[model samples]
Target: MKILHLDKNHPLLFEQLSQLGFQNDEDYTSSKEEVEAKINNYEGIVIRSRFDIDKTFLDAAKNLKFIARVGAGLESIDVEYAESKNITLIAAPEGNRNAVGEHALGMLLLLFNNLKQADSELKQGLWNREANRGTELDGKTVGIIGYGNMGKAFAKKLRGFEVEVLCYDIKENVGDQNAKQVTLEELQEKTDVLSLHIPWTEATDKMVNASFISKFKKPFWLLNTARGKCVVTTDLVQALKSGKILGAGLDVLEYEKGSFESLFTGNDLPEALQELMKMDNVLLSPHIAGWTVESKEKLAQVIVDKIKQLYGFGDDEKKILPPKEYGVSGLGGFFFKTKDPDHIKAWYKEHLGMNTDQYGWTFWWKDKEGNDCSTQWSPFKEDTNYFAPSEKPYMMNLRVKDLHKLLNQLKEEGVTVVGEVEEFSYGKFGWILDPEGNKLELWEPNDRAFL
Candidate 1:
């Protein structure tokens, strides 16, 4: 397959793909319009936020099978429009998650200890330690927004610290041992430090405005390692001035250009940014939270692997053997309780890289002899009686070879069966109960029907 590289990456990407018999080409200095004229020639495109891939660009690429981004966010691309055209979108958030986590922790420590100001004073030969007296992070409650890859990584870094880590995500069941999942209101009420790890979208752009800052019950420190546009610069400066925000450690700024490679030239910056630069309580970096020495290679490798895997050219040669005799071959699905199903589906797609819909993730695998099979992983509303009679938190779905035969055998064995056997476009399904009274779903699948 033909592939086009919009930006230069590590040599391994080109070498690996070329070795796998894919033609590779590069065009780094072309204008967007110039590249658009020739995009239909290739089946794949690799990018790193060099320019916006809008509907116009999507319409031009008639042959594009996929678009691979070497970075975490796909904000530069029209993801919905491209996907509607059957073009797969890929990103490498896992590659740089650790780097971002470390950077966030470093900024938090810098803010808490007043390290920047203290170092500047010491360099000037001043010995006023009282002015730089710092507070500790031990007793603080840290709240994290967006429980995705970056958010989870940041929480993991805080595990050793004596702080209560709370996470507020749009999805339920995102909480882990490192952080407790909480409602956004509860997070704002109890947090002493708030860190943002969300993306830039219509709903999130300028989300942290004056009204949002005012909701916090206490003055709090802020750290933003996510998108710059998520917080309004004017509102942040106002909060800082009014003491609503104790301090801010920002790796990104709202005034940054779309490319994020440069800021406004000369003295053309807005008044809020100018005022922010003069604040002693604030720290800024050039949007390098996820840009580390190791992450450079990791991102390239991740992109290469994903592209290779998508095309079935991966290096994994381990063979999968199918079951010979099947009362139940393997697990077919796992459905559990959740407060919100749609939000949880959004979380799965954003964080775990699962392409999900209302019913949730359709896990596709291969049987022996390279035949395709499918399964399901979904979440139901907490109040739903789907797992009734036993009142269990979850239900297991087992894949069987024959639905009617298994139901008859189960009945003969004196097992308690629930409801009658049902058949749908995707498969035939039946319900039963184990001796412990847990509900189970049996499926004889038709993988092609769903596909």
Candidate 2:
């Protein structure tokens, strides 16, 4: 596949794609107009927040199959329009989740302990330990919004801090041992500190206005490492000044550009931002929550790894697998019971175009990369106890990707997992009991291992 590398990125991404048989063109300096003019020439595009991928840009990229954003947040991209055109959007939020989580925690600690103020005072030759006294994080009820990658990462990091973390997401069944999932109302009522980890969308823009803050039962500390637009700057400033918000730590500002750099000149910044800059109770960073040095390589690696998975890039001995268009991709293995396995196998060989082995009939096929792969078809003895727990006479295996992700999703949806996943030399396997009591086998194949 031919890809357009729009924004500058680590060389490893290009190198990995090249190794995967993908031809890429680097045009980091090109203007949006120029890039749009020739966008249809490539099958894919890898970018950061160099420019917005709106409807017009989507229209220009008629031939684009995918858009890989190097970092998290697809706010700059028109997701609805791209979906209508079937252009897959891929982002690397997993790469920088830890960085963002750590940054958010650091900002919170800085605000809570008055670390920034203490350091500033000491440097100024003023020692006022009593005035700069710190507040304990232990026993505090911290509320987390949007418990996805960043939120979950933050929750994990907070485990040692001895805080009662309550997480609330619009989506339900997201609570785990790390944080107690609760309703937004419950979160607002009980939280001593609130941290935002939500993405910026139309529904979320200015979501945390004065009215939203007023919903809280008491004054609380605030932390936002998500998006600047999620919280209305003016509303937040007023809340902080009024002591409705005790302290605030923000890594992003609503007025920031799409590229997350300064949108306005120093003289042209919004009135609220100017006020925030002068506030002692507020801490601000230039949207660098996920901007760690380690995250640079991680982000690139994640995007490249995703690209490889999508295009069937690794393992030269095994061809790339076909993409599943529906719920299940293909039959992993088909099994049935018979009184006489050998007789049935001979009968199938005599009638159907089948070559049966001692164990089973292995159907071979080439992957997208023209590598070897096979699926097994076998007939077990009628009295075999392999399908024991269930008295079913047959068992079916389904092929899947990201096995753990699918398994977790199933569990969250309250599906009955038969047992834990078992690893074998050939692949990783798991079992689930369907509604009809059929023992279904899920396999994430390791084709190379079989070869």
Candidate 3:
């Protein structure tokens, strides 16, 4: 399949894809208009926030199958629109997690020790040891927000630091060995140091402002290696000025350029930012916490590996892609347990006009595409354990077009599909538990084989 490389990335990405026999098209300097014009020519695209992938872009890329992002953030991409079109998305957050973790630690250490100020003073031949006294990281409570890849990495790095780590994520069950899972209020009440590690999403935008800071019981130091807009700069500066916030170590800023490419001009800086720049207590970097030399190569390598895994590259060419149209067509079968299978079978045969055979009754039907199909009805013994895990007395199978694709959609919709898809000579079968606790079976029939 043809793949478009729209943004500048590591050379290893294209090299690996080419080795896998995918036609690679690199256009790092294309305008948005140019990209839309040629989007239909490729099956996939690789990007790193060059431009927005809104509904318009998705509509234009009619042949596009997948979008691979070189980094973790998807703020620039229209994820919902792409998902609606059944476009696959791949991201490489794991690649730069270590770099971010180390960078956050380094920033905190520098701030805590007043290292920057001391170093500058020493270079200028002024030795003021009394005023440059530093604080210890040991025995301090550290709060971590968003315990996904980046948060976990930061917690991991703090293992030997003798700090009490408390993690609060919007997601459930995210606590691991490195930190104790706690509520947001609990974190605010306990921590002396607060670190942000979440993505730039609607919910997280400016999540840390005046009101958020007021919830803290202690005057805490702040670290933000996550998205810039997560913290309201104005409120942060106010907090620092009021002595509510001890200090801040920011790798990202809310007032960053669109592409995160340029340093801010002094004349154009916001009033709060201008004040922040003059503060000795505030530490800043150009959002390069995850841009280490090692991470650059790791990011590209992870992307290539994920792509290979998704397409099953080199495993089997035929299984490289899932079926396109995934939808339910009709009922495949109806099953129920009875005290007397013979009696239920006789009743169905007598009252329902079903011509019962030895195996049971079969109702023949045709689909929208005029394919012949059949539905089966059977009654099993009351004590049967065919539905072993679920004690439901009955099971009904809905015929579907693509089993894997349907399962994927069901998962996305918050419907919990249970177990692996079971394949038999008759069809492929799967199961799910409804909110009411009924175990429902789904089937994609091998009608041609039966015929």
**lDDT of prediction 3:** 0.88
lDDT of 3 by residue, 1-451 (tens): 9999988788999999999989998898979988999899989999987778899999999999999999978888899999999999999999999999999999999999998888888999999998889999999999999899999999999999899999999889999999999999999999999999999988998999999999999999999999898999999999999999999999999988646776554557799889989887889999899999999999999899889988886444344343346766666678889898888888889998898876578888765568777888888889987665667898877777788888888899899788899999877988888887777888887875223
lDDT (CA) per prediction: 0.91, 0.88, 0.88
Q: TM-score for all predictions?
A: 0.72, 0.72, 0.70
- The per-residue C-alpha lDDT of model 1 at residue 327 equals 68
For each candidate, C-alpha RMSD in Å?
14.9, 11.0, 13.6
- Model 2 segments beyond 4 Å from truth? 265-267, 314-451
lDDT of each residue in 1-451, candidate 1, tens digit only: 9999999888888998899899999999999999999999999999998899999999999999999999999999999999999999999999999999999999999988889899988999988789999989998899999999999999999988999999998888999999999999999999999999999999899999999999999999999999999999999999999999999999998878778888755667799999989988999999999999899889999998888778876364633444335467667889999999999999989999999987889888885557766778999999989787768999998888777887888899899999988898878888999999999998887763322
Better of 1 and 3 by lDDT: 1
Model 2 lowest lDDT segment of ten? 319-328
Which segments of model 1 are wrong by more than 4 Å?
A: 265-267, 315-451
Global fold similarity of model 1 (TM-score): 0.72
Name every residue pair that clashes in candidate 2: 319-371
